[model samples]
Target chain A: MGAVTTPKQDRSRATRQRLLESAVACLAEHGWAGSTVTVVAEHAGVSRGAAQHHFPTREDLFTGAVEYVAEERSAALRALPVQGRTAVVAALVDLYTGPLFRAALQLWVAASNEAQLRPRVTELEARVGRETHRIAVELLRADETRPGVRETVQGLLDMARGLGLANVLTDDTARRRRVVAQWARLLDEALG
Target chain B: MGAVTTPKQDRSRATRQRLLESAVACLAEHGWAGSTVTVVAEHAGVSRGAAQHHFPTREDLFTGAVEYVAEERSAALRALPVQGRTAVVAALVDLYTGPLFRAALQLWVAASNEAQLRPRVTELEARVGRETHRIAVELLRADETRPGVRETVQGLLDMARGLGLANVLTDDTARRRRVVAQWARLLDEALG
Candidate 1:
């Protein structure tokens, strides 16, 4: 039988979801140093106690936030239309240029130095990386067994990420459109 | 005669140099949070007062570190043999995968969130980015007058950065070699 949710339980779940979303947004804007639990709680419009109840520590909150957004992004990727290479490439590139990526970037920078947060971020990033690669393979219909095909697809994702990095300081849209177009052409040739 | 340096002046100059190098190394290893002036001074084997003397604030120390290494990297890039596209691509990619890049990445992550540090880092990054682009053009012999050539060069640099980010988690050496090779081929065709 399908499980039924009570009103109180549904409300609690919604609050938790809001907190997670709010935390990601906070991390994206504030980095680890500035994104405190109280601040995130305030941003979420939830009490500090409620945030603490959901996430016992700062590490749990940020890591949980990244994982939540990553799952949401994966779902979004899965739901994308089966458009051709150009559209698929643009979608993948968009993944890195968005708030989720910004949040994850902050987490990565923090985890690189924070001993306590390192392993969790490492594992989360690996899982997210693998998921994105797998999706790219499926979406592009790439057979990794073929010579250079895996690298080509992987290269496309890396190039997208590089574009995202370039966009961090300035709007790289004009150059990015040209780059994306060229990558689409490259992917068409290389993937085939 | 050129002005002769006294022993005290020479020692002070060496101390300042040591502090700058140590600051970069510390930022690369420990990142922004753990990289205090006292820590950098200890790493450089200088007194805290001496470190403070060289850089009056944390902002000064880290910014000076990035600037110092950037100058060094620019000189090194300039001295590279006008190798063919493949070797030049490999060398360019190597720039992102090195310690200097690691240090710069940390600084960027910090600057993205820290209001006080943002403007300086943004200016430094822009200068470095432009310098690298100019060098890449000169090395590749790609005339920017031709359309898509600029984006091609920029794409390669972005891919190199993505590869650098990938390597942050694990050794992406084998995959990167293949990607770099493919990029060299792409560059050959696109540049022509």
Candidate 2:
């Protein structure tokens, strides 16, 4: 009985996973204006009814994408080896360099036009704020050098979003790296 | 003949100005997605034909709106009393506190969806970057102690944008004031 139940659960999970992956691909390729529920259904190789069953509307699909992107980002953050400051900076830069960041950027562009989507987008933002703030507060708690360091981290994160957008548009690796190192030093100074 | 020339020139310029103003208001009120050429024409109390004569398409109208917004921001920046760093910080905070910023934000949201609009948006961004960089370079040149100052100024400016956005959403005067002081201190450190 247990063996039979395990494969059944796995199949269900795989289906859900497939749907999420398809949504991200569709979002990146078409953006929100061009990515509709029917299109997503076609892209996912599922019936329209199946896509609708998973995500009732375009907004629901976008909401799922936002949550999916956040979970992926948080997972990436967790995988980072937080041994040194440089390590952390490298991890942060790597986070922005990958496909997930690109998909998130596409969602951000989509969210800008759709008022209904802003809440979902901002909800993820608040999640990042609180979670990132917790990490900053913990990191600085042991150090006596810099106070008000959490705000510095938050500011870096915010600026990095704009920088990330610029990176996508211009492909300026040097400037992006400059932003990362400069922000790291600022964090250290603030910590001190 | 002189009277006719003055009024004709003034009338033509006023029609152009009114069209621009109406575009901004329509954008702010209806968002970029909702604001159509017909809607802007209605807002300006002009016929659709007249609006079309002035702005051939929706993209052109939006382009005009962006230019108008940039000019408004420039005018505001010029009016700032650059007597001291503190006043300068106040001006920076003030820049994002009102309707113009809201309209600009709306356009940003809109531009993300419209491929045709992105170039116009990038041009504006480049113009602002160059102008701001020039100002920072000038200040750094004047100050003897500030070395590698451009990076610091740019980072501080980026941080100031986040602070200003927070201020706009929360009406948090105290927070804005603190950010202003922090910005001023950061500037002093970079310049001194």
TM-score of every candidate: 0.94, 0.82
**Residue-by-residue lDDT tens digits, candidate 2, B1-192:** 555567768886788788889888877666666789899888888889988988999989888888888888766666555467666656655776576766665666456556888778778866865665555445334352444455666655555544544433335566556546654665565556
Which residue pairs collide in model 2, if any?
A: A145-A191, A145-A192, A146-A191
Clashing pairs in 1: none
Model 2 ranges off by over 4 Å? A1-8, A93-115, A136-146, B1-5, B93-98, B105-113, B136-147, B161-180
Cα shift from native, residue B14, model 1 (Å): 1.3
Per-residue CA lDDT of model 1 for B51-79, tens digit only, reads 89889999999889989888987888899
In candidate 1, how many Å is residue B192 off?
3.3
Kindly list the per-residue Cα lDDT of model 1 for residues A78-189, writing each as its tens digit.
9888989888998889888888888888888788788898889888878988998999899988889987787788888889888887777667788788888877876787
Off by over 4 Å in 1: B1-3
Query: Local error of candidate 1 at A65, Å?
Result: 0.9
For model 1, the chain A TM-score is: 0.97
lDDT of each: 0.86, 0.65
lDDT of 1 at A28: 88
- The residue-level lDDT of candidate 1 at B167 comes to 73
